[model samples]
Target: MVNANKVETEDEYIHVRFRDPDQFDEIRTPEWAEDPAHSVSEGSEVRMGQEEGSDDWQVESVLIKKNVGEDKAKDQAEEIVEKIES
Candidate 1:
């Protein structure tokens, strides 16, 4: 199962560990959050998708490791939907 981490500071960027034992890929904050659409708030869930001028990788499917804090996941999910619509 995917684990949600508590983002304390810059040291706390999302660390995605592939569940597949054979797969080994790490996506950091600045690197993973490459597209302008990919943002990280204190409490919000951001999905991966292309906006306009973004490259091919822009519109890929990325499920961010969520947070354990209170209502953070729900808030983030809502924010992401808003962003996508806008």
Candidate 2:
């Protein structure tokens, strides 16, 4: 039930519109709209990591569902880090 569309990109930031009715109702600016590196939820984290031997970095973000346990966000971070490292 989660989806996203890239709206725009700049040298310093990228704008993405996320679709999650369970979390939002309409196409609206996120609470952390000002910072592409900010997450809507405290548990989640958004960041850009430089790729190996490349100047460009990859945009990554993850959110833990409410049904999940409290440490779900940290678990998500670990998974993302593992994927990026591999």
Candidate 3:
């Protein structure tokens, strides 16, 4: 609920911490929002929030075309990470 944006990543994801992580315990990750299969992705859903403790959230998963090249994929992933850190 804080911010939203597009990002690419194979495994790296952005996590948001909350003042009360325990309150979000009842929440659950959607079927489509499950973790990635360790594949490349771009413009994938940049999710935020955790299901339980720390009220944290993370990049649900990234999606990229199968034929996409490595450089572009890597750049996209890096951009997502940079946005998270910055």
Candidate 4:
């Protein structure tokens, strides 16, 4: 099961945890949002990083997009976590 997290900052984002952080490459970029076709707003982005004081890894997707909705961001993040953990 994937647990969603509340973003602690002004940036609108969706967060999730992974059991194994080392199995994949961590990506942080806004390029996905740059094309205006990725369904994300101009400033939207995604990244993977270590969660402080925890064995689980975290992936955050900045979701305030002009396209469909923020649901895409959470869905994408959840997909990644599930893929990597499997």
Candidate 5:
């Protein structure tokens, strides 16, 4: 996921494109999966849900599997910023 701090409110919903482990390129979004209902902190895992006729995937919940110390969080943030800048 992109760094939460760098994301603006208006650009919260992003279309993601990535390569899978098997070397296949894929895009994982439905047209309606744009209007997310919740925001998550950096390093949190999120669950997305879609209503039958809805156009966006809602944020169902967030899971913080582990707590990162301030130093590590800062490092991660910096790495994210570098990625975005490049």
Candidate 6:
């Protein structure tokens, strides 16, 4: 889940909910994601991964679908979360 309000602050960062099978974690928007034109909203589904031997996960892309509804975006996020947890 993304915290909608947090993105509006001066920091221009959003809070993302992350799960690691047995636990839930929180991640903030990275510097690469600070561009207003490409910034992700509360329901956006983003792809994230870390480089080999690196501990930090970086946002790779934000998935966008034409005419998709907010509910659908949320569903997508949930599905990704489920896969990660599984």
Cα lDDT, all candidates: 0.34, 0.37, 0.40, 0.44, 0.32, 0.38
**Residue 34 error, candidate 2, Å:** 23
Better of 1 and 3 by TM-score: 3
lDDT of 1 by residue, 1-86 (tens): 22333322223333222223222233123343434324644432233433345342221222333443335543443344344444
- Measured on C-alpha atoms, candidate 2 has an lDDT of 0.37
lDDT of 2 by residue, 1-86 (tens): 22333233333333332322333222222344223223333333344434445554343334434444435444444454344434
Worst 10 residues of 2 by lDDT: 19-28
- The better-scoring model by lDDT among 2 and 3 is 3
Instruction: Pull out the clashing pairs in model 1.
Output: 44-76, 45-76
lDDT of 6 at 61: 34
Error of 2 at 86 (Å): 2.1
Model 5, 1-86: lDDT tens digits are: 43333221112322111212223222233333222211223433333455555554433322332354344433443343333334
TM-scores for the candidates: 0.29, 0.29, 0.35, 0.35, 0.28, 0.31
Q: Which pairs clash in model 3?
A: 21-54, 21-55, 41-63, 41-64, 42-63, 49-57, 50-56
Q: Tell me, by lDDT, which candidate is best.
A: 4
Per-candidate count of clashing residue pairs (backbone under 3 Å):
2, 0, 7, 1, 3, 0
Question: Which runs in model 3 stand beyond 4 Å of their true positions?
Answer: 1-43, 47-51
**Of the pair 2 and 5, which is ahead by lDDT?**
2
Clashing pairs in 6: none
Candidate 5 lowest-lDDT run of ten: 8-17
State the displacement of the C-alpha of residue 55, model 5, in Å, after optimal TM-score superposition.
Answer: 0.8
Q: Poorest 10 consecutive residues of model 3 by lDDT?
A: 14-23
